[model samples]
Target: MAKILVAFDTRDEGFEKLGSEHEIIRPPKGRDFTLEELQGLLPEAEVLCSVFDRPARAELLEHGTRLRLIANFGVGFNNIDIDYARSHGITVTNTPQAVIIPTAELTLALMLDCARRVSELDRLVRRHPGESTAIGRSGYLGVHLSGKTLGLIGYGRIASAVASRARAFGMKVLYHKRTPLSPEEETRQGISYAPLEELLRLSDFISIHTPYSPETHHFIGAQQFALMKPSTIFINTARGSVVDEDALISALQSHTIAYAGLDVFEDKDIPRLPLCQLENVCMTPHTGTQTADARRAMNEEMLENVARFLAGRSDLDRVV
Candidate 1:
């Protein structure tokens, strides 16, 4: 049996399925394993159950003398050094199927929160209970969603799910990806493919779903923001590094974009000063798939990857 090192503290239900055959090392409660803590355990670990918060850099990957598989707990594997792992003959996998719906739901939630100013108004009522300023029709006006153009930055599973939800709300969906879909496929899904520039300029609501990589780092910056409408509502459920936060702040401060709803940020924790202080923006603590159902699904998928890899199966969810 292999030594499985769990770098994050997920619930024990899924891991319990491994029985007493394999040894599992877990971090302390309420925290992820630090790099230093992980390094000490790497030599004996044949598998690593990784989370997105911690960086699985080259130094850590190199220390895994017995490492065979790195099963990431989330869909996006940006936090792990995939190239280095492959170079060292180690396999890397992620729980892609598990996060699709929950992340799409979070994206929709953020979109509605920004468009309706839900969180801001809720906070207003709570901070000053029974205040008249919080009331009246003209006091806190917000945008309506029906018949608005929604642009998706990536045409992945999560983005496809978002498109379905957007269509239900009478939103016109446009998507921009590395490769445009054929006209027949577009017609079937009711989503039109547009060039990046056109999508940026025309979309009233823009949702980013692209993965983070060297080619996509700060993919949306000052120039891209400049192309957007002044009344645009921006939503990002993807990695924070995909957009330049400094440029995003500049746009928000100058009203270059009307509002932003963000689930991720460049900083690992709470965002920088001006973003936190912005009244026109709404933020979540990167809890895109924090629901109990999604967590359980991710754990199951991760375990399946570990099981398949150990059994010498090639049909598993192998990303790298």
Candidate 2:
């Protein structure tokens, strides 16, 4: 039986299938395994299961002398060193199928919250109960989602899901990707393929859903932000490095963009002080796929990858 090393302190229910077939080593109940602890346990493990937050770098991978597979719990595998794993002949896999709906749901939620200033008003209510300022007044007016245009930076599964929901709210959706879909496909989905520059210039709301990589590092910077309308609301549920945070902050400060709704941040999930102080920016602690059902589904998908690898199967969600 293959020995599996799980790097996080996750709940035990979904792991039973793996536990019955293999040896599963995990951290204690409430915390993740420390780097040192993981290194010590890696030598004997054949598969390493990692989470999105933890960095599975070469320093940690070097200790896994017997490692063959890295089953990542999230869709974005940027936390792991893909080049190192590929060079060392270690297969890397991610749970892309499990994250689609929950992430898309959170993206829509952020869009709605930013458009209506939900979080900001909620904070106002909590700070001063029964206050007139908390109520919707001329000074506290918000925009409607209807009769607006949403520009999606990446037109993948999650973005497609967001497009469907946006249509229900009477919003027009435009998407930018490496390859544009056929005219028929675009018509069927009620989305139009636009060049990035046009999307940025014409959109009322902008959302990013691209995976992070060296090629996409700081994909949206000062130049990109300058193209956006001043009334635009920006949303990012993808990696923080995809947008230059410094540029984003500058844009917000100057009202280049009216507001921003972000789930991920550039500095290792911690929002910088200047960003936190901005009243126009809404932030979440990267909780796109935080629901219990999503977590369980991710675990099951991760385990399935491990199981497929051990069974000599060729069709797995192989990343590298």
| Highest TM-score scorer | 2
| Tens-place lDDT digits, model 2, residues 83-197 | 9999999999999888989999999899899899998888887888666653534766789999999999999999999999999999999999999999999999999999999
Total clashes in model 2, counting residue pairs 3 or more apart in sequence or in different chains: 0
After the best TM-score superposition of candidate 2, give how far the Cα of residue 177 lies from its true spot, in angstroms. Answer: 0.8
lDDT of 1 at 270: 59
Of candidate 2, the 10-residue stretch with the lowest lDDT total is 131-140
Q: Alpha-carbon error at 223 in model 2, in Å?
A: 2.0
lDDT of each: 0.91, 0.92
Regions of candidate 2 where Cα sits further than 4 Å from its true position: 130-137
| lDDT score for residue 130 of model 1 | 69
The local distance difference test score of model 1 is 0.91
* Model 2 C-alpha lDDT versus the unseen true structure: 0.92
Which stretches of model 1 miss by more than 4 angstroms? 16-20, 27-37
